[model samples]
Target: MAEQPETIKAFVKLGEFLGDYCQFAKGNLEFNEDQIKWLHKLDDLVARAASHNGWFTQGNILYAFEQWSTALKTDNLKKWLDQYDIQNSNPMTVAIIMAGNIPLVGFHDFLSVLVTGNKALVKLSSNDKILLPFFTEYLTTLEPLLLGYIKFSDEILTDYDAVIATGSNNTARYFEYYFGKKPNIIRKNRNSVAIIHGDETPETLSLLGEDIFRYYGLGCRSVSKIMVPRGYDFDNFYKAVYSFKDIIDENKYANNYDYNKAVYLMSEFKFLDNGFLLLKEDAGYASPIASLFYQYYDSKEYLDETLKRDADKIQCIVSSRPRRDHIAFGDSQKPALWDYADGVDTVEFLLKISNNN
Candidate 1:
C-alpha cells in the first residue's frame, strides 16, 4: 500500500471528485442541459428507491444532496481529513452497520472508508438497500478503484479491523454484544430537540417544520420533540408549518401521530393550542402524533435540566442561540460531509485504519 501522505492525497482527490459529482447531480454546474437533466433523473431514481423502501420523500432526498454539496465546499471534509491523518494509514477493513432513516444516511461511512483506503463490508438496513447500491455503482464509474472495495452483505460480519453500527436503543444492546469486541462505533436511537424562545420569526418557524417532518420524522437526527416557552401560541407556528401538510402522508407516521393524539385528547390531557398544533406540558422529549407537538416549560433553566437528565438519549439540539452550531429545525437529516453521525469522528476512525494503529 502507499504511504500515509500519499494515501491522504488520494483521498483528497476522491473527495474532490465526490464534490464534483454533487454539482453534476444538482444541475448547478456547467454541462449540456440534457446531461444535467439526466443527472437529475438519476436523483429521482434514487428518490423513488427511497420511497419504495420506506425511507423518505423526494424533497428530503434533494435536501440531503444540498447539504452534502455544502460540506464538500466547506472546511468540514478537509478538517476531518487532516484531523484523522487519512494519508498515512494501512490498508484496513471497516464493517459499517447503516441506518435507513434518511436519504443517503450511509454515505458518510462510505466516504470515510474509501478516502482512507479501507475496504468496506456494509450490512445495509432492509429499509435502505436500494439507494446505497445505486450510489456505489455510480461512484465506481467515477473511480474504478473503488469497485472491489465496497461490498454489501446481509450475513453477519466479523474479523474486521473496525466497525460502525447504527440502530435503535434496543438493537444497540445487541450490536454492543456482537461487535463490541472490535474497535467499534456503535450508535443507538437518539432524538433531536429544539428550543424556542417564543420570539422566532415565521420563516424560522417554517424551517423548523423541515426539521421535524422531513423523512416523516424517522431519522435519529430528526427533531422528535420541541421545547417552547409556557403559553406560547400555536397559531403562528402552525400557519408557518401548514404549507408542508401535503408532504406528511407517510402512513406509518400519520398513524403514529394520530394514534397518540387521540389518546392524549381522550385522557383529557392539558395542552396548549395554536389551532394547528398542540403543546402539552409533558416532562419527556419524545412527542406523540395528531399534533405538531411540543412540551411546554416555564423556563430555559428547567429545559436545560431536562435535557441533561436525558443526555444519553439526545443527539443534536437546535437553538437560535449564537453559540450552538445545532442544525436548523429541518436540517437534522441533511448532514454535511463532515458531520459524522452518532458523534463519532469518521475521518479519524479511517485514519486509524490507514496507520494500522
Candidate 2:
C-alpha cells in the first residue's frame, strides 16, 4: 500500500475526476471515449438511485456531487487532515452502518476510515445502495492499492475493530447493545434548526429555504424547525420560500403534503398554510416533510439556553449571530471536511484506534 502522502495524492486525483464527472454530468465537458463510458455509468446510477429510495431525488444527487467535488480539492483535503497526526500503522477493519436518508449520507464516515488508513467494512442502507460502491470502484481503479482496503457486505457485521453507525433513535438502542463494547461512533436521528431574528433579508430567508427543502429535508443536516422572535409574521418567510413552491408538484412530495395536511385538519390542529408549505407552533425538532414546526423565543439569552439545552438533539444551527457553534445561514448543508457529524471527530477517532492497533 502507498504511504500517507501518496494516498492523499491518489484521493486528490479522485476528486479531480469527480470534478470532471460533474461537468460531464451537466453536458458541459468535451468527452473522450473513456469519459463517455464513465459518464454513461454514472448517469445510470444518478438516474436510478432515487427509484430505490424516493427521497434521493436526481437534483439532490447532483447537488451532493457538486458539494463533494468542491470539498475534495487538494487544499481542502490537506487542511482537513493537517490538524490530525495521521500515521502509518496496522490497519483496523472499521465497520460502517450507513443511513439511507439522502444520497451519500454516510460518505463522511467512509472517507474518514479510508483516509486514515483503515479498512472500511461498509454495509449500505438499502435506500442508498449504488452511489458509494460505484465511487469506491472508481477510487480503486485510480489507486489499485485500495482494492483490499474497501469492502461492501450484506451479512452481519463481524471482524471489525471499531464501528460507526447511523440510524434512528430506536435503532440506536440495538447498535449500542450489539457494538457498545467496541470503540464506536454511533449517530442517532438529529435535525437542524434556523433561528430567525425577524430582520433577516428576503435573500437570506431564500437561502435558508435551501437548508430546509434540500433533499426534501431528509438529511440530518436539513433544517426541520425554526425559532423566531415573538410575533414574527409568516408573510415574508412564506414569500421568500415560495421559490421552492413548485416542489409540491412532485407526486411524492404532494402526497406527503396532502397526507400531513389531512392529519392536521382531522386532529383540529391550527397551522398556517401558504398553499405549498405548512407552519405550525411546535416545540419539536424533527418536523414531517411539507411542514415546519416553529417556536417563538423572547430573547437571545433564552434561545441560546434552549439550544444549548437540546444541543445533543440538534445538528446545525443556522443563524447570522456570531456564536462559535452557529453555522451561517444556508451553509448547513455544505459542511467542511472537519465538520464531523454529531460533532464527533471521526478522523481523530480513527487515528487513535489505528495507532494503538
Candidate 2 residue runs with Cα over 4 Å from true position: 1-4
Report the C-alpha lDDT of model 1 over 214-329, residue by residue, as the tens digit: 76666777776878888778787778788877654666656665676677789999776543345666656566543544777887689778878888777788876534546665
Model 2 over residues 269-324: C-alpha lDDT tens digits? Answer: 99999888889899999999999999999998999899999999999899856378
lDDT of each: 0.69, 0.88
Candidate 2 minimal-lDDT segment of 10 residues: 1-10
Best model per TM-score? 2
In terms of lDDT, the poorest run of 10 residues in model 1 is 1-10
True lDDT of residue 255, candidate 2:
95
Task: State the displacement of the C-alpha of residue 51, model 2, in Å, after optimal TM-score superposition.
Answer: 2.2
